[model samples]
Target chain A: MANITTNPESAGGSLTARALREGFYAGIVSLGLFVLFVGLETTQNIRNELVLRQRWGLLLTFVLVAAVGRFLTVAYVRPWVAARKAAAVARVRDESAPDSFFKRNFNAIAIVALILYPILAMLIFGVQGSLKWVDNFGIQILIYVMLAWGLNIVVGLAGLLDLGYVAFYAVGAYSYALLSQHFGFSFWVLLPLAGILAAFWGMILGFPVLRLKGDYLAIVTLAFGEIIRLVLINWTEVTRGTFGISSIPKASVFGIWSFDVGAANNFAKVFGLPMSSAYYKVFLFYLILALALLTAYVTIRLRRMPVGRAWEALREDEIACRSLGINTVTTKLTAFSIGAMFGGFAGSFFAVRQGFVSPESFVFLESAIILSIVVLGGMGSLVGIAVAAAVMVGGTELLREMQFLKQIFGPDFTPELYRMLIFGLAMVIVMVWKPRGFVGSREPTAFLKERKAVSGSFTKEGHG
Target chain B: MAPETNTATDTMTNDPILKVEHLSMRFGGLMAINDLSFEAQRGEITALIGPNGAGKTTVFNCVTGFYKPTMGMISMRQASGKTFLLERMPDFEITRDAKVARTFQNIRLFTGLTVLENLLVAQHNTLMKASGYTILGLLGLPAYKNASAASIELAKHWLEKAHLIERADDPAGDLPYGAQRRLEIARAMCTGPEFLCLDEPAAGLNPRESLALNELLTGIRRDTGTSILLIEHDMSVVMEISDHVVVLEYGQKISDGTPDHVKNDPKVIAAYLGVEDEEVEEVIEEIEEIEEGGKH
Candidate 1:
């Protein structure tokens, strides 16, 4: 309801009084929230008895920080944004402006950059130093980008609230891990098999909950996720219980070249490069990037097809969809299975990357994270979800390297411990700032004369 | 006054395109419709007019396969002599296999989709086949490409017919109320239905819009030979375009005849005007006098 095109003069007139009121309210709210946690600390005495130590000074500083931040945001930042918005409104009076060269060619530029990332990192930081950037940041974020895009098919296009998408991811990972270990199958063979198995599971989940919509569907999916995790945990004869399957084989270049450090056909020896593990990390990074791009390409292509339009129509109005001769059953199932297939691909890549598959890796929290990435990125927008994954996943991974924080909070302080808190705060900020998400407008699947982006206000979130 | 005896069999002796015989729908203790029987002729607009709580929409639901009737049979015969017992078919098959499409009493366009896309969705079954269930389409085969182009052309044809070609690219939700209603009809037409059922198509339209709707419905009948069965409270629309009118009250038909015959029926006058038995004759005479004075 925050109107970006509001008159700037009125917005600027009440800055002081409104900011003071808002700041005062923020101070009170932060006081109430931080009272117990920041005001008191639990510590053990010499005799090992628990005691509550008061930290009133720390609490007061937190409250004042919150208040001042709120005050500055309201008085200065809001007015500046309002004025800028007004100027923008005047500049583009009736029609949207043409895209700049950078904006138009953004995808090409990003793809080129991603393709060169591992090589560039090795050139800049050497093999030993480039491993973390290639493996931890690049590979990890691409896996999530793929997973989020997969879930977007169900929750975004079809309007199905599937809270158990991690189940498919788990199925994919476990399929590769179990199959490779038991049958000695290569990663290349197991990847497509894993996707098929996961898609099968997706249809199985889709069948029973076909009649459900909205919150009811979400609850069932949440339970389904837990069920898959629990099955993996208890099926000791097959899944190895909580210990999981380890030493999962690494993926190769179509089973022809291996990235193994010591094999006869190893990548390093064949290419006459040094025997460093960085080559494997670089390989994994490219592999995941290719997988992510495949997901994006397939999704973009599907959006223009009839099945995809049917899914969207089913979302908009199921009754109307049926009345138009669309088979809702097939439409819903295709969305579920296709989405699960991508999750499966990402899962197999995950197993190959970590060399492990366990119930601990596929939790409800993981599903929530992937779903949030899809939502925060603007549900149906591939670019938005990818950017969201980078910011959220990469941001958390970056927290581990914040050794400079020890200078202020002492050597005992770990920024990694506050990753969840920072994540929660970021979600809140995004929701408040851009509720429709980073790229709220929808790109139409088909156009007659000209393609126009449908505004978020004109688009429905869908009922089921 | 005798419903079954007054059936509109005298006007057109040809087989009815749609026949609902002894149809009844019951929700718990309440009978929404009981022993309702009517026939809609091929390529003609048949109007179902009823007072409040007369189960007009419930009857439509049965005919459109939204709800299975509790008793009796509703059969639809296409031009090719292929007959479908609608009550036995699923809702989508009624539209797909039976070639029967419908618009809701409340507008139900895919609001998030563009005006053109709304029509494209109606052509989903055809394109889905041509796309080889998307395998061919994803590969961008020439077959799929041609199908896609033809579907868009069909959607454009409907858009032009509906007078919505100008706003074909805009989101359906952004259209005005009248435009949205027209878009819904355009979308339904894209399905290529032989029988189209409209539930309260003129419910909220202003007089001018209602007049425009009358033209669209009549034009569809004239050009496409698509029979229309519409439920309407707009007397002007019903009186102007409908070949036959069926009147209902308290889930029972009171009159069935040509529009003029039904309009002057004393029983219909009592049911619609809510007059007592003795006042029915007086009300009919008053209506005749008004018509005579207006004629001059």
Candidate 2:
């Protein structure tokens, strides 16, 4: 086979012209999909006279942005990829060099920031506006951070591609919701139960799918998640159908039930805190912070243990793992259950935090977002997962407040609607740029004389 | 087919660690292993040598619990005096409980893991429990830490024996081909198996590495008293390390004896040289003279 190497100079073309030519082709495709399809409906306004007027300005701007973005990407990304490939041989050897400062200290800095979340929230957003920032960015991102860490065990360490992780999340949420609503179980009481229930479901899903691997395993897991969702939606008597179970109850602080309080009898009032939703939001933030920390601590410890090594071994080569006397069945099941257990903790926390449990929240998109967080964060990396969760989840939330874009794109522009579009673009760009995400370097769980962090170059995306 | 009364020529016959009785493995209509019986004696090296597709790997797979034979039984006697039907158990149970550890024909080290971690993973069952199923280990409990330290010591010991101690912290994939092969054997040995099954351990090794492998195998037998069943195409390795040689031709055992006895066997030479029954004696004489000269 002849290897084809095309140099820009050999091609005898200007970079801008080449990029513009490529961009023009990509722009045509984008224009067809965005302007002719998705954007057309969004821009149309059927006013009082029943006239279908098109917002041509927004459509044109969208096309131009897409074209320009593609042009710059074509111009820069290609050479960058070529350079990365050129350094590939040396990179693997250089990977085991002493831990780079950023990868080593990212956790300490992140933890300090996380520890001071409440104080930081107070300073940045203030008492009145802190609730939104804390609840949406802090709690929401932490919940996902916990979820990604959980999924990391299965997809990252075990090399099991699970597309139905949300099933376990739903199991946790519903376990808390149903237990709380039907029997009036308190949040503290149902917390562990939710985890146990989700783990049980994880095992149930794990058992029948032991024979599957790679893509087949992913499909089965995806189906399992959908089944859980479909069951939740159809099992109307228990789940209340699509209406969802609401007003489930807030998480109690210090095991003392918050229980039905209106100002005078409010727990927050008694504690000398403001008797507003901020109190609940702030309480939930701390609760999730504790939960997320627990997940990280456990995951870090497991990585160095025998069970953890078995998971990585199985990921490396199942046949080799089995030949070496590692019980793959138990290893895989434990990965699923343990991962689901953390997802369950996050899920029940979600229930109490939102005071609502719905099939809508446990959609496939939720699984995709969580999976993306794991992948985007660098699989098997706890700090990376946390960072990724904050970037992805917090980035989407920030988009809602991107009203400043109205100055350029017109007042009709809602940045919120382009969340998925932006997310998809960001994912592609990140994948192209870093493939391994923020902290791709991995410090060997067990080492001999020298302790060096191995870069992602030595490990596969799914491999530990 | 008769349940092991005894055969006269059973070398190292103090106790047979592994017994294959009329084990026939059929893949659809194809019989990979015919009704063949053999015993690997305790604390000795047994080599299964055969031509390509002669089902040497098939026998190894069946013994290691990777395959379930269509007919007959593979019984493995553990060091604890408990006998296990390997065909009945899962792959891991054969390695764990039955104390049978194996290496692949192609090296299958945990490429992403460090050399030490690869060996540590082979000792998974012991450390997994000591870690209290990861709970105490996660908490940095003393007992689990001690177990982890001990396992690392064991890993280091094997790494030293395999001459991989210097590269213990290196990723297994980054090692050279010969080193990876040695690492795979060391990893399997770290499992503390009573019976070691190696498929082509010296397959791609250079002359020096092959000599090192022979020493490693001999050391395992002499020091650890591990009964090894090896499948090798390298005649030098088989003749030097193996106490008993079993030759297969089209899934049937053609010759079984000490290396010299098999080297002098007419049928063995005929199978290797692809000759008629009448021409076997002539070829055997010719091959024996050459083997004698090649020995030096």
Candidate 3:
């Protein structure tokens, strides 16, 4: 196949071999930097006493190693790789066929995988006590996935930059917390209410910035998020301020029994087995999974609908959208409101799960993380966003258990500090390697016959 | 003047669909459209031709609600005798309610979307109307499904009309420049608008594309009873296709007549020649001398 043509210039030559050579050189440089850092920290005792003021030698060693690693890669590895890429580009003079079968079938495979995953977990690990695996990895990932999909509606579908997505999440969580606590409403009752409340807030946010565009809109949304957080913090009478509202009701077993087995409740009586938190976890998993899938399904359906297409039209070209008779203001408002509604759903689920509502929970960093998930996953891509969240969030969480890395870097070394550095590096690499996204395809909302995924291609800057 | 009066009476008897009454749009100190008045009759191709930056697009934009004019009223009368104040309505309402549609100078297809999707998006309001905007419709109600099916069929119909059926699945961006221009017109047509305003439809089209575009515009006017207002630079396209021609110079109306009359107007000739008042006589003398030399 045509896959072997790595050197875009030399169609006949071994392009893969060149890529291998470049990868090998990069590995050697990284290894060399690691060794040098170890030597400096252990033997040479080089120190930077001024900067961090804690462990001078270790800090200096890290700094030097990072600098040298980056410098070597930029000076040698990057140029060498770019030259090969240039060669490869020349080889592929006749642009390849735009469609790929693999890309087209990606969603089909993803749907199958999503369906099979819980079943496999139940079969292998059993459904009894698998909270750690199911809740942490599966449910948590799906929550972020839902949020990413929601934000995708605004940023990807509508081309409206919103930095206060977490505000909706806060609204949902607070809605659930306050309503459930006050009225003793079940999860199902609170869920829709929370979504509505969040949508209301979304419309409220939409009205002010109806005419704003680009960075100005982004700043306004960002300030709006901060204002919401501040209000939650200052409103001690209702929200209880920073102390937060605790003992928020957890989702019961289909309104049958609570997880608590005191004089008040008993799930064991209904199921004929001892009640376990695992039931709650499993139930929560399915609940959130359904919600996430609901978000995805609605988004897909909407895209094929008039409003969805209008959003894309607005995103692509606002001026043209207006001329087409698409009410851009209403279109934008619908996008924001819908996106916030989903965020609210995820937030309420979170509040119910944690049994708490704290201002600290809904932070700018959470919004950044969610936005990063959307960006890293690729805009308007459902599967890509989920995968990005899994990699980013799950990877960071997985890093906490890396006890062996401590042995290599000595007792005091923590990998968490390097997480941001690694994330930054990954982002830079992703930008250089796949500028569009990992699963870069401008996915269509609806398909003609069978839904086919389109591979992402480079769009002109102004167009995107 | 008596003959002019007779022709004016005949034109007025046709009953103008779009009436602009002393529409004056000023941008600070500059008058973009100064006391501009015109009438576009029903089921006719009205050509608005002008030099670059001559307020041709400004008139289109103001009519289409992209820009709110500083002064005057734009009244568009439908076949049903329902009148819409174009300036008073919101942009979307103008399209959704008033049934006015438009195309841009630069072909603005949702490049990322497929050829069919672009047309389907234009039919958004119609589909929404069929669905009733309820949760049942969202959950794949039979009516919604039928409407969606009809939408795709309508999209395919327009795509075929535009000669882009073979490239239906292709991303609109991948199409050649001329194809994109035609696609933009097809998209506007999908909306089923009473009046379609085209801004520089033949700007960058090759001769063959221009001919094809002429056929499409004529076909639309003939078959659909859709009035067309076109702003174009291609003299061949305008001269061959336009029923009525409105000429603008320096953001002001210099000539308004049929294609034959506008073509023969001295002011129109002088504007196209880019000649001053003093040079007009000299140029005419030079042209006569050239004709005399050719004869000799």
Candidate 4:
């Protein structure tokens, strides 16, 4: 964050001097650390009747890199960055120029990639191997993508920071679990049922607390989430308490096709296909793919409607929204219900995918993860959230394959142990680097002949 | 559509479009407005002028249904031969049903949205209908598309009026302060309101901007046939555009007449140009005495 200023020459002079001072100070500090590190390790080796290890070369490497890196950063990197920023400002006048070919065609490319993802996965990993990649990475990330998209309608577009969105997910999962277990409702029958139930609960939870705003709203929504979890835990008779509902029926296409093990009506046999169970994973993959697209489609459509504009307006200024005749109560409630409905859809899929429902799956951590995806992606950005979800969820799942690290850190080293630790660190690094997410632009629902991206930085305070 | 039935008597006038009959508002121990009454005739700019904290904004809030009055009624007689109680309605209904729109003392445009979107949001009630409450719109239905196009047309028309058509796609926040003030009024006008309440429309405007505002307010009254209720401390704007003037002090109507009459009214001058507490008492006494003498 070296700010650009008018007098670049003078500023550059001062910057170099400061860099030299910093480098000198760092050099002294590095020398002290070097002696301490070498002396302590060497003394231990000497006491243990071993050769006193002298690692001067390694210490010198660290010292040189630190001093030279800081000097180079100040002398060259900072001024280069400042010059580039000035050039960008000059380029703003000629903004009628079209975006680069790749940037303009990015959406079309992304859609094509999504459509061909399954076949590509199959080709790369073969049939059986592709199932893990599809189910663990593709389906898993898409669920979060859908969750983030749903939450985008609330936190992103609507500007309501809903921390406890997982409550709706739990509501959907339990709805499908309970309804299927007791009433014998099929997946098709209960799928919409789960969504409706979650939506109703969203309204119930939203009504009382919609008046609260910002931190107050966040706190109340959080309490609502904890209440749902407590209800599930305490109301053991209905939800089976902490033990959870097990052996939940798998979801199928119209109840005729299922992925059950070697059943007479197994989907693999019914379709007269191969006996591989990867068929089910592939189907689940496509199922989630369809569902995620539906979520994105609905969100894009809603953003252009009066209701959607009302939500953005309310987000910008509540007082202004009321004066303009936008029914804030209706707008907020609709956002909550619709967002929760999508959460429910994803939740029901989660239940059938796992073939079980448990309180452990519907924890506060889950809500935090979904919310992180939305924030780390751009708020109200459909593609941003999808990319963020893939990076976060798929990346975490990818950690399981890092067994090669044992070569560096000994045979006992395991990478999975530090997954969350690394994830948290990465989040901090990213947020500090770019306070706004990757695509923090507010694209107006209605525009003239040309559509321009309005950076959120220019947006009024309360709205962002 | 409903037939106009003259209710219990409000002795202000026979045909004023917006009538505030003895409206009062109190917050905690503060009487923000006390028994204030005014009438804004159809297609005329009525100015509400007062010193700071005179509760002019409070009255606007009451008429717009942002604050329900503690006493009395605000009524609007729309062209449909229907009279709606403004105080009884909810905030949104005042705009959607009563067809009354307002701008704020401080500009409150949706700064994140484009200048065009702000106008579209003003026509939310109309487009929402064509959207069939969103289902048809989601399906990309023809009716919704036609309505959306129409709403954009309306937005463009207002942007042209505000001289901001070029910045239609620019974020509302990016506009200069003067342009933003004009955009606010234009956004309110896009609602197709019969009654427009502008709170300090010229609050922070420059000389040229203020002149433009005067012309815009006058044009709205003349061309659109929309009655404007303006609250302004800027006397130049008040003197230029207003057809009628009501002066408030201590949350009481101190002077009520034409701009010429109210400008020379000693009580209004004493209240605005600064007066001692003793002089204020005298002005109130003079007003009450004049009110009683007129009644007799």
Candidate 5:
């Protein structure tokens, strides 16, 4: 058995090595292109006026570089890495060693990388301006990550298809918005209140669907989400209809400084620095970061609890879950409510961050994006969701900066136009290459002792 | 181990654990169970046997709260004299509150979960109730931890009883056919039910596997004091394990008595033989005479 496994690994390793070599060459070519772009931008006067006007050489060169880069990365780099890992695993097995050399080395490197990430980012962009990366990429994605994990408890763990997940998020956001706007409640007071309100809505959704199953349940939940959005859109008196509610209150730093109070006793002023609007952004960054971490921690803990296991069982088979004396209705309700509660948390955080709330924010597209994260990442896997969110959200954000591509496709080329095309291509490639997900294993939050990677076949297909 | 000769005064002889009083179920126009009345005694292996579509499964479903009866009632009295209206409760509450656990004709283990996890999930309600799902419990509260540990212990205990401790970590779906059936019963037992209803528990088992299953059911009845309501087609299993038997034909009770008595009944013979009812008595009498002549 061991020999059979090792044979495939060794074969895979050689393939990976070849891919790595190709990737190295592609990197060199891209670097040369970058240098050419810098030269063209700086030394325009040195070239003939006709040469600059035609620009055929630059356009041709840019296209060639992009084509070569893509070819090398896909045809060689990806396969090479996969083969190398496979071969390394085979070698470790042949030697009968517990921990491979790479595993031990990678752990140490990861620890160092994590420790230096924030410090290095601060140095590169300045602490105040670094808020963009921390907020947009970090906190924004983390909120979705939390929402995905919560949804996993329902759709992934309990096998309950809940399309109305955004309803709970809307509930939480509205809960916080209404309480603060009407009664002058603080962020601290409304955060839990939002969760409770969302949970209440979750139960409301759960009750009517107690007898529903399969596609029927899905349609009902989908309708429920649309209903919530329509209500927000049409209820002009309270929600202000499609105009939306603006100038919403932002979360403060323990009431240390009013955001509108100018630089006089502001948070940055206490540190003897000029208070920029970026100060508030940084504060919001850390606030959502903490909330996201708390969400992950709570979800992890819940999986080990009886209710968590019940949810998994329910997911596997409702008949068996009931036969085991689990109240299926209650278990389903708990999963729906708990998942909704987290959605609420993320929704409320979104409202505060943007300082606005609108019906458009809770559209079906948002639900689709979040669901894609869960499916693409591998259901019930926390780290997978985080990586998936980064890939989907960060990839789109990165597309906006591809200015070099504009020169190749002419000035008419807009990167955003190809965003959806690239996104769809990436999804198809991932699905074909790794159908069970990038991280295809059931990583239960809690276990008896040491955790091991259980195989991925147990979960729904197209998810981990 | 004389098989407990005190059966006359055992729980089986006292107030019946499950009493199906004139229960009838209809699907549109066809009556699945028609005026079927019988009592399953506690600590007794009672078998419900007939040919296919004899309403055995329907009766079991109605009793377990899976199907609502169109007419009649299923009254179950526990040792504490707590009478449960089985038809009134949902399937979940039937298992949780009434302590009525059942196995399906097609074994339905949580195939994705490990063998032990299947049993642990069966004990879900107990652990969840004990923990109260508070924030303290979510924070790994001591009581919650203890309950979780106890659940694992119970799971391990049942896994050992089912002779599946070695395969505890394997997915339930990976088990061989017979082991999967045994695991299903063990999972049901983990729920700590007062009565265990098995739908075709020995449907696909070989002769030896079926005999082993009989021993397991007998042991459950003897040790746990759990009433056994089994719907089986295997005559050997029905004759070997069942202390009482109810025979159904066309959704009605044709015969009800001890296994031997029902086995010899003309009505039961006609149901299995597919003969006219008028010819049943003639065939039974001839068979009895032949038996008597052979004995002499």
Candidate 6:
């Protein structure tokens, strides 16, 4: 709409005037929004009474920044974008141009990079220094990538908005924790068991909500998540309440090699290497990388199957799907169970890696973060979700290592304090710039002579 | 009802592909369809013509199992003499088991899917069974691969028939209006339906496109021996293609006969032209005098 209103051929003077007016409006709006938060601060004086302190100068500075930012964006960025768009339109594009070497082998390159991530980190930061890099960044980002991919099947392909997806993750985690603790089951035995349990719960959630759609479905799923968390918190006899299950056994390589330092069959003993915690982190990293790849592989393969097509058809239009003899009930349920299955896999991995399970870890915020990763990565695109997970999860983790910021802010400012604020601002910018996420185009699951990417405009977000 | 003037070529009236008996559908206080009964003979194009709001689509909804009739039975007897009660079955089962396929008045294609994919979805039941309910398919088994290829072949056949072979890989939503309508019909054909019910297949088509649609429908009837029942306001299409016509007015069957018989029926004429109860007789006389004058 703004594109239509702003004429490219406007007089130079008028353009500047318009930009100034728009900048002033933006500044006024920002002032109104920020005055209470920035202009005044509440403090406890020596007598322990609340006192109000004036920060008008800081408020003015913020207001001036907003004004200048708006002015520069309107005057420079908009015109530059419009000119680039015009140039692109004027040029006759070569539709059949071959892709660059990097573009053609992007997936292979990414896989290779992921396979070598932990080893590369060790070479760069050495043993102790690389533990934080590998465990905190590599393992952390991969877990989110797996979770987001799982949720993508439900929300992206099936177009079912599941607000309480973390419930399934919790189910998987707790299933592994309790079953292994009580039954003395190995991590290998409980991994698939956890997935099956989560899928069963997915079906349990799927049955009653079959008749519901849109906002109604979202609300029910949200309530279901909260219910699971509350149960975990209050079920003290089984779950240990808020104390959580602690000192859970670490995962092993098919019961052959354990990650423990003192275990007789430790990975270091088997490999004839020196004892180091980095070995555990590296092993866990590879395990998660394999699991994440499995999720991607299954999802991609399923998209080409009949059930997968039916899921997408249900997303397109339920009435039409029914008309075509596609059973929507089974289609939707399959999406739910399959999506939950992956979440379960990731949750079990999380439990093993952290050596604990707790209801607090499976909060609604986890679901929101996973969902945002899917949305920000462009729904239904595997590679895009991985990139988004790295940027969001790894980006936030990177903030904790910003020791240089202490020098600039007089050793008082903590970059982590502004993490959420920065995360939110980045989200807003991305949504405005690329509403369909980074990779908007859809690759057809099955193609004939030549495969063509379906434009974002042709796809629907779906009502479910 | 007008006298039965069903074509001599299709005299097997005892064996109708579809039979709707005493079907009535009520929406709250509005009687959308009142005790409507009609039979579409095997291997013939049957047209249900009516003025707007005469409950033409409501009857279709009942037959397709989208709306269960308040009171009545819709029986579809396949060629093998197997009878399925469509009204009792669920919407998908109506298509899956009864082998009854339908197109909507407003086009409802899987717009995001490719044109070929839209057709493959209609063959979902067949391929699903061959895939061993997707277990074997997911494993990339040879049997499932062969079945998938066969399904694609069937889709390609229909795509060629619909003159949409060129756009098979494009998203269904990206096609032109006429192409989308034809794709819907093509998708319905992919279901291998014993009885096809199309609601306003030529609703927004121009004359040339309508002519092409006529050819497609006739070719389908000739080649596949699939029975067709359509509701259309385009008299040109109804007159040119349909073997029998059923006319409705205000939720009641006003006329039923061959196309020529229904075209000459005074009730159908008045229904389309909107004449008052008292003025109907006068208009009938005016139509008769005009016909006599043309004869002279």
Instruction: Give me the candidate number with maximum DockQ.
Output: 1
lDDT of 6 by residue, B72-134 (tens): 888999998999998899999999988999999899998888888898888889989988898
Candidate 4 residue lDDT tens string, A304-346: 9999988888788888888788888989999999999999998
- Candidate 3 residues B10-102, lDDT tens each? 464566889888888888998899888898988888999988888998998889887889988999999889999998887777877788899
Off by over 4 Å in 6: A1-83, A90-92, B1-13, B275-296
lDDT digits (tens) for residues B10-49 of candidate 1 = 5475668899999999999999998999999887789999
DockQ of each: 0.72, 0.62, 0.39, 0.64, 0.42, 0.66
Minimum summed lDDT over a 10-residue window in model 2 chain A is located at A42-51
Model 1 Cα RMSD, Å? 7.3
Q: What lDDT score is found at residue A348 in candidate 2?
A: 93
Could you tell me the C-alpha RMSD of candidate 2 in Å?
A: 8.4
Residue B138, model 2: Cα distance from true site in angstroms: 4.0
Fnat scores for every prediction: 0.87, 0.81, 0.39, 0.85, 0.55, 0.67
Clashing pairs in 5: A12-A83, A13-A83, A16-A80, A19-A76
What is the lDDT for B59 in model 6?
Answer: 94
- CA lDDT, candidate 6, residue B272: 80
TM-score of 3: 0.83
The C-alpha lDDT values of all candidates are: 0.91, 0.85, 0.82, 0.86, 0.79, 0.90
Where's the lowest-lDDT run of ten residues in candidate 5 chain A? A47-56
> Which regions in candidate 4 have their CA more than 4 angstroms from the true location?
A1-29, A40-97, A270-274, A460-464, B1-14, B275-296
RMSD of each: 7.3, 8.4, 7.4, 6.8, 8.3, 6.6
State the C-alpha RMSD over the true interface residues for candidate 1, after superposing those residues. 0.7
Docking class of 6: medium
Q: State the weakest 10-residue window (summed lDDT) of model 4 chain A.
A: A38-47
Local accuracy of candidate 4 as per-residue lDDT tens digits, B146-176: 9998998888888888889999999999999
lDDT of 5 by residue, A336-409 (tens): 88888888887788788888898988998777777777888887777777778878877877787789998999
DockQ of 2: 0.62
lDDT, model 1: 0.91
Top candidate, metric lDDT: 1
Model 5 spans with C-alpha error above 4 angstroms: A1-118, A257-265, A444-451, A460-464, B1-3, B6-14, B134-136, B275-296
Candidate 1's C-alpha runs over 4 A off are A1-79, A94-96, B1-13, B276-296
Positional deviation of residue B189's Cα in model 1 after best superposition, in angstroms? 0.6
